[model samples]
Target: MTEFANPGVGTFAAWDYVVFASIFVISSGIGVFFAIKERKNASSRAFLVGGRQMVCGPVALSLTASFMSAVTVLGCPSEVYCHGASFILFCLAFSFVIIFTAEIFLPVFYRSGITSTYEYLELRFNRVVRVAATIIYILQTILYTGVVVYAPALALNQVTGFNLWGSVFATGIVCTFYCTLGGLKAVVWTDAFQMVVMLLGFLTVLIQGTIELGGRGNMWKIAWNGQRLNIFDFAVDPLRRHTFWTLTVGGTFTWLGIYGVNQSTIQRCISCKSERHAKIALYLNLLGLWVIIVCAVFSGLVMYAFYINCDPWTAGFISTSDQLMPYFVMEILGHLPGLPGLFVACAFSGTLSTVAASINALATVTYEDFVKQCFPNVSDKMSTWISKSLCIVFGIACTSMAVAASLMGGIIQAALSIHGMCGGPMLGLFSLGILFPSANWIGAIGGLAFGVTLSFWPAIGGFIYPASASKTLPLHLSTNGCLPLNISDLLSTQLLNFTSQERERSILAENWYSLSYLYYSPLGCLGSLITGLLISRISGPKHTTIVRPTLIRPVSDLFCFWTDKGRKDNKEKTPSDNDRIIRASAEKELNDVCIQESRKIPSIYIPEQCTHINVLCVKETYF
Candidate 1:
């Protein structure tokens, strides 16, 4: 039998190069085509939101691709392999995420008709809140984009001998080019194509691996007997990594922050032709996310079963768990000329989709919130050019950040920690706006500042002073029957030593730094919400008495208790209050008329219809 060694540089064949190169060429071609197609009407709105004429199918696929970054592609399988299938339980949270996002957050942003999600903060609170939220989002996206790009590049470097930086630049530049020139339309379409490629590649590896492991039944039996099929770890311990509580309850808040208020997702939702279509896209995205995650989980089980008698980690074939997926691909499909290349293409596809979405979203929020506010009179043509330029600039910044991420210990942990830090605070601010009507701007600003500080403290501390040992649970493995005698000896020497006192810290240190990262989003969100409520109560009520129904939760309409209380309050109003109520009723009437008209009209009929209706209603009310 032949001995196995770690794959070195130049491990990938020429056909593999062809497959990888094709992705770049096709992605760039799509960008150029869209750039030329929309050249005549290159307005900021068109570029940033695809003219708000996007369909549900492509938008849904784009959302799925954007959310399923390289971290999911490379890290999910590794997670399953290392800690069993408890990670799969997180899939349970997707439905809740979709429902909450659609029912609560989508209507608010869709009704507001804002280009940037951060704009909601400005409308509900003050400019200070808007600017703060934008900055936080920008930081989060930049950091997260780097980690997304880095994950696949690191895997490629390990399996194919490709330079990590080379892979990073290649994916980053291609994504930026398409996103810059093609705008949101190009980004969404390419993302749809990439998602298809990713699934094809993943399934190819999974099917081939399962067959080679003596079919699915044997594979499952081996994995189950090895304790790799533990799907439900119902432990309530927050300190334990993958429990039912962490995966379900904690995952709900994590995904809520991701799908609910993140600019990338909000942009996709608003880009749809109507709120109905956006909801369809969100549900479709949920389905797609589930498919990709299931594929990853099964691929992990296949890898574990294949390597049962030949542990790669014990044999020193790969340095990190993230490398396991790519390593398994090369080992199983290396002989099938183009398959390895397909796997590399899949990884790059995920990275490109994520980075492209982020660059477009970043360019969008930057242009709309900061640049356009200063230069509101800039022509649409000039605005489009400026937005494209911002895409390129942020693309370079993200690539540099990707370089920094390469030095980090774990891709999934680093990416999620960044998300929790920024996304949590941003979600908190929006939650206060949507769920709590009395939360003022002063409260929002103060709560956001405090929440950000609280999240950053733990994240930075954990990274700087990590535990001496990792906290991952072990999976059963044996190498006694391996062909190579040396591999068997290596496995024997590395006897299972799960006893490590790595996390035995003081109570204070444990509470602060050892807080499970899963709870970061919830904690930060609750921190912001509680703080905002307290501060708002202390500062007393705001001078303005009006409450926009669209800006708050729609639960008032469903609960008769709330509706009855609202009616009672309305009856107690003074003459001035009655006049204001009459104006508000007129505005609502105008909105209803506009909605009815919009349904009958073509797509071209609604350009800032909400804004126009507000203007007409105000002019007719008091004049």
Candidate 2:
């Protein structure tokens, strides 16, 4: 490892340490102030959802930070390093999903008047589906948070010489403190600060790397000639790693789990002041992610250029590919005035921000899904306390998992694979709730079980089916690990690389960019949608009216017909239909009671779906 440099205690510059320390202290300071403010408004709903008054700027920035975690900063660079420019093109596939979400799901969620996004499951299908989706989210959050927690600490340990576990706990501890105290408000505010520091630190490294590598032109020339910049390989091979089809499809599915179903992203959108403001937040967030992703991918290209002949992983400078970016930063930029400290702090900030956001979302799910529904009489104060307590516990659990991640090499691949495995099923469950109106409780539950079981296969062992099983069916693995990378390369060379057309076909066949990450969203979404529909059809439609489908427009529109017609049919004076008379009598009694008690309660502020004119005004102010 190049005779590990001993940064002597006396030689350690005060200014450099101070620069990194300031970023952490300043970020925590913002979180602490907000935590104090949020504690004052300790209503259960307010603590979890920020009283639904969050403006666009904070929401946009926080969402950006939440979305761009250590995964984007570290894993993406590794993806580009291993696969090349095709990973960069993968980001574009998600832009359309973001657009669809802004127009389709955002409005429906706002109108539904629920705090947690999983509430849509209860309102649409049944409590079982709601519980199923909530559990999947909690499971995914823990795994995802563990990765975000582990990767950056590994990087920090490489750069700053801190204990691996110590760095993970230290980062998790600060995030837990403010997140537990301040709630969503604190997480969002702190994320805004973290996002700024993260970008500045990365941009510093990128510019420095460019300068050290001669310039942008030199970097690209080397990358292009070495086949690192190739994005298109028009071969129709299923075993290929990154094809245009896989990139678009897999990338879209992967992001849908993050932005569409994950509570971390949903929490930000729900906190916005109005529906239009939420869409604006989402739009601005997509734009920011585009910029951040390009920068991250470019960072990888620069790393490739810097170490083309002497690849760090192959040369044994670093133990794994994920360490490539960290080593590159420390090797070239470590000697700069304060740049090393800035990048190290940024790396930790990415981990901390994501863990904090995930912890907060987990707490919200616990309170809303399990506590409130299970124990309907808990007081607001106690409920808020439970939420805070859960955050503390989950934070500790995630820290333990992060420490464990060190022993398991290929941190990026492990983290991403875990996400795909856990997140794919969750996305499927949500799709069933939003897309299929007739998805009864039985069907929903069955689909959940099936999806969860099916997604775990690739993680345990590579693929189970025959090599040429499905036509044009790209080989996929849920977890990204070194074992699979070695397997894929070996198999491709010895078996699949034989054709005169195949070896000279395209570099994409050799690179890891074969199946783009975008397809994960559609695969998961449609997979669950079909599963739920088939199950519901087999169950033969339950007699009772299912919960209202209020999250997505099409499902809600379809179910509204049955619910409305049933109400109208019963309202008619038809004594011949004895069932109708009983339903009408029950409705009359409920309406009378509702009228008698209407004047006693105060109304809460809830944002409503707006008209085009109001939406325009909201976009102007929010954006």
Lowest lDDT 10-residue stretch of candidate 2: 598-607
Instruction: Give the alpha carbon lDDT tens digit for every residue of 1-623 in model 2.
Output: 12322222212256667887786687678767876776667677788888889999988889888868877777778777767777776567669768867765666666677778887777666787788788887877786677788877776566457678777777888888888878888888888888998899789878999999899999999878867777876665534546676666666776777777778888788888777788899988888888788888899889877766555464334666677677777777766767777777777777778888888888888888988888888887888888889889888877777755665445555555566666777777776655544456677777777776655643443221212213222122111222212233433543453443344534433332233233333445566667766877676644223233234444333332325543344222212213311355554544443334322211100012223343233223312
**Global lDDT of model 1:** 0.79
For each of the candidates, the C-alpha root-mean-square deviation to the true structure, in angstroms, is 8.4, 10.6
- TM-scores for candidates 1 onward, in order: 0.87, 0.79
lDDT of 2 at 134: 86
lDDT of 1 at 398: 95
Q: What overall lDDT, based on C-alpha atoms, would model 2 receive against the true structure? A: 0.67
Q: What is the overall TM-score of model 2 with all chains considered together?
A: 0.79
Q: Write the per-residue lDDT of candidate 1 for residues 11-103, one digit (tens) a residue.
A: 678898899899999999999999999999869999999988999999999999998988988998888887788778778898899999997
Candidate 1: which pairs clash? none
lDDT of 1 at 539: 69
Residue 102, candidate 2: how far off, in angstroms? Answer: 1.4
